[model samples]
Target: MTRKPSGQRGPVDHERRDQIIAAAHEHFRLYGYKKTTVADLAKAIGLSTAYLYKFFESKKAIGEAICSLCHDTLLSDIQAIVKDNITPSEKLRKIFQSLAHNGAELFLHDRKMHDIVASAIEEKWHAAIAFDQELSSIIRNLLLEGRERGEFERKTPIDETCRAIVLSLQPIRHPALLEYNLETLDNDATMIANLVLRSLAP
Candidate 1:
């Protein structure tokens, strides 16, 4: 319980709420959001369903909370990378490389993450669509910047081209994008980064 702005006592445990969200992340990451029930979440956190309901009424809500945490972190990372004085195309490469090279875990783990998101809600839910828009926007910015820097053709429409580039990179997160036995996923990411840089360069 806590004191409200109105001076009456209210009840909300923000810290515990985050703990539950963390537990939800682990559960969803393992069993996926679809297969993970509220009961599972409650059990994982050592709480009853009734208590879990007090925090998050549904599994979808918990899933959204987990996705929000992940998406925010990635978005923040992208923003920081873009803060450098690099050209737009360079920035785009840096953004992707950071995810693929620096954060390979994010790409590989996305297999389970994708399943969770797809199961928890519609593909266009805020968390999913927001990321799509954020990437598209980044690509659009880079396209416009590339045209000015002579790094790309001026005829390319900013939004469409960016979306295409973003979609193309999705295969990197796919389980079958390349054979893991032949080369490590890290090597594949490097190959992909080089391929995109060379192929997309003017």
Candidate 2:
């Protein structure tokens, strides 16, 4: 939640923060990180840079906010897919569907998202890898669990399987792969997710 320095607003500060994030998401999706500037974002959000400053110190902060939102959404979707006490195969199928259903919109709308994230790799590598690592850990642990549960093939190393899932996700970084393989980015998401899930399933 963000508080007005003047203490003038009498509402939940979280709402105001969400509004800022909405604006950031729109602007960044359109102009991307390198092309986006503080002044433009401030103007679009109908606030002065000084006021915006009170909430976000820099463009990178906005990028971080965007990344955080995407990461949370991805995790939530994955969690929902696995929330029920279903079989491993069903969990894998749902994971693919969830990622495919919503993930394509993310890449199509903001093609520059990966670049913005990649640029931050050197400085914020840990933060940048947090989502993938967490998801990979989940995959690895699940595979181990699945093996013990007699629900999966007992062949490849768990780490290797997890790495494959994460690497399949990396195809989004390729412009041609994103554009050509499927009719649209959204279509691509489902196709890729399906393939990944199959690779892990028996």
Model 2 over residues 62-128: C-alpha lDDT tens digits? 6766776666777888887667798766676566556554545555565776555555554563345
Local lDDT at 113 for model 1: 69
CA RMSD of each candidate after superposition = 6.2, 5.8
Q: In candidate 1, residue 14 scores what lDDT?
A: 78
lDDT against the true structure, per candidate, is 0.64, 0.65
Using lDDT as the measure, which candidate wins? 2
lDDT of 2 at 132: 68
State in Å the error of residue 77, model 1.
2.5
TM-score attained by model 1:
0.71
Model 2 misplacement above 4 A: 1-15, 29-32, 107-127, 172-176, 184-202
